[model samples]
Target: MSKKPVKKQDPETTGHSWDGIEEFNNPLPRWWLWTLYACIIWGIGYSIAYPAWPLINGATRGVLGYSTRAEVAEDIAYFKAANADLREELVAADLSEVANNPELLHFANANGRAVFATWCSQCHGSGAAGAVGFPNLLDNDWLWGGEIEEINETVTVGVRNETNDDARYSEMPAFGDILEEEEIAQVTEFVLSLSDDDVDQTMALAGATVFADNCAACHGEEGLGDKSQGAPNLADAIWLYGGDRETIMQTVTNSRFGVMPAWNARLSESDIRAVAIYVHGLGGGE
Candidate 1:
């Protein structure tokens, strides 16, 4: 049998053509088209099953009533439930006992660190190194005693806070108005001598008399501060303000009164105890 020649069929093209190029009108591949259709269906199903549409007051309550907020609440509830016993034990345990139990100590430290970072990092540095006019937690120096109970007490009832009646309160008399400028300078040199810093021998000798008359009652005769009076030890290099001559002069002339907020009303009892432990364990607690 003789074979006939096959004819070539031209592909359909749009009317527009540019520079010998033409656009072919081709149908999408079956697989690709089906995939796109499936995606659209999935999107519609999702819109119906979850919160997707926005309304006037709030969002839509989808068929499944799924909510991100509800999910988060559930997760929070689960977390609290898991940690409830441990937290209760921490709350019930004595402040001293917290450190004795390994698990309790670990939990308290972690929570206390988080709490410190959130609440205390602003005044105390992120590392709790402290700043000018702020007491450093890393050192053994403490205006109040550094015992765990004392620390807890100080934290509960802060220094110079007005809200708490039993707050640790102390005031340095502003000697700028009380004494002559020369007298202030003399006392500054005397204070500097307490730390064995180089100072004017004659003026410090004279200032000793002035210190005995005015400052000895609060700051001991040796300048070893009284914890009962909340007076800072002047014999050490750890100065809350500055240790320089000028700074000492300013302190003597104007006096420094700093305030720390009472956390008793602000934080839970367990939280306060935890922070006290955390601060005490920072290599400074007595």
Candidate 2:
């Protein structure tokens, strides 16, 4: 028998499907919807209070004026203020006076030691043991005099700064300029001989006159260098420049210059005094 024709269904109301699946028209949970809305609101608030967006010229500055550098500067100023009185007292007192006062000297030395560790330690080394080009602070050799006043002056004005009136200025003329190369060699040998406990008497006898006429001006008549010019004493074993024959030849030919830095503006008076005391205490102090 023929089946009755299937009734036509309207597309809007039809629940027909090719697969075994059904569709439903439903709304999302109210809490979920509200949570999304809250996120957007919070983002906008954050942008306003904090640096969030990029501009053509620069990034936006946050409402709170916080900066890393400003904090550091403030900390430094606070520390400086805390030490102002001590710094003032140190500046007023003479170096000798500072040395005499045990309390002040101790304070000065503590400060100076720290400063020395930072600045002087690089060349002079820790404990002022010295290096290839640097002088040993523990020894009796004072290239420019070891007296406290002398050391203070050396630290203040320096050894070679032309601008400084009190700079320890001494120049050893190159004998090679006036003397023959053989004479320069002879004097160099003689200088070396002077430092040696067992030197050739014959060679030294010949070189003595050469030393007197050409070298005596800076390196005293006895080969003991003039400290006023930072000239190292040859009579002793310590040599600021060097003690080798080749080194002496070079010094004789080209001349030698030793430089000490000026610390007047950088360091305080008490600090320098402390350094002088510390240096003096190091076995070599007079």
Candidate 3:
């Protein structure tokens, strides 16, 4: 039997070539071209119908007059109007009495958690455990007083922040240039001895005198710390930074200044009260 002749087919190429390799001048599929053209038209229409161009002040409010911010504002206004009575009640009610009202308490806690997550969770952990330099809210140890009123005040005015004139203010003098190296060491040793039994006995003994002379005003003679001045109790072993000897020395040498913004500037009174109530109920409240 004789085999049939084979047919050969070749596509045209563009006049472009690289290293003797010809470029195929293939037309895009008809469906793809139509889709591309449709998209280009849709894009142009969308640009005219919505915000697309950027200006120095803001983006253009396109023909459709659509604004995401305006929508959000409307939604917020609706919610605020709906909850106005409850929020007013929350603001008016005493902090201690907030828990007694079931409806008020529920509203406050839910709102408070949201507020805390948005504002407080940045420094304090999601669980309010706190980070280094930040105070842990879950523990009974408090840099300032942990009472609901105190928490309200602290949240309202903030701590060590220059923005609020009435901010909870305290400054621990950096003892690096103030104290002699040996005195610093002795004081650090004494600070350690307040929490730990195992320390250099001689250094600790000398440190007691040094502590009395220098740190006793804020830290107390017994090293129990003064809450009025935001001084931490050294005897409790609860450290804002770390309890290590070197860390303590560094802290004494260069004092720590933690700043919290006055929430009153950003949040309403009701929101602040809600937050105070939420924090108080977090098991660390006095």
* lDDT, candidate 2, at 168: 78
Model 1 CA lDDT for position 129: 94
Give the lDDT ranking, best first: 3, 1, 2
- For residues 128-228, what per-residue lDDT tens digits would candidate 3 score against the true structure? 99989988998888777999999999999999898999999899999998999899999999999988999999999999998999999998989888888
RMSD of 3: 1.9
Clashing pairs in 3: none
> TM-score of the candidate numbered 3?
0.93
Instruction: Give the winner by TM-score: 2 or 3.
Output: 3
What is candidate 3's CA lDDT for residue 15? 85
RMSD of each: 5.7, 10.9, 1.9
Task: Estimate every model's Cα lDDT from 0 to 1.
Answer: 0.89, 0.75, 0.92
Better model by lDDT, 1 or 3? 3
lDDT of 2 at 72: 100
Q: Could you tell me the lDDT of residue 8 within candidate 3? A: 71
Worst 10 residues of 2 by lDDT: 9-18
lDDT of 1: 0.89
lDDT of 2 by residue, 1-286 (tens): 9999999763452365658755543456999999989999998877777777899996666676655667899996896688777767877777666767787777777777877787788888998989876889887788778776676677778877666777778777776678888787777778878778566667677788898987787778998888766667887877666787788788889887767777776776656765765666567646
Off by over 4 Å in 2: 1-72, 97-100, 268-271
Q: How close is candidate 2 to the true structure, as a TM-score?
A: 0.70
TM values, all candidates? 0.76, 0.70, 0.93
Query: In model 2, how large is the Cα lDDT of residue 268?
Result: 68
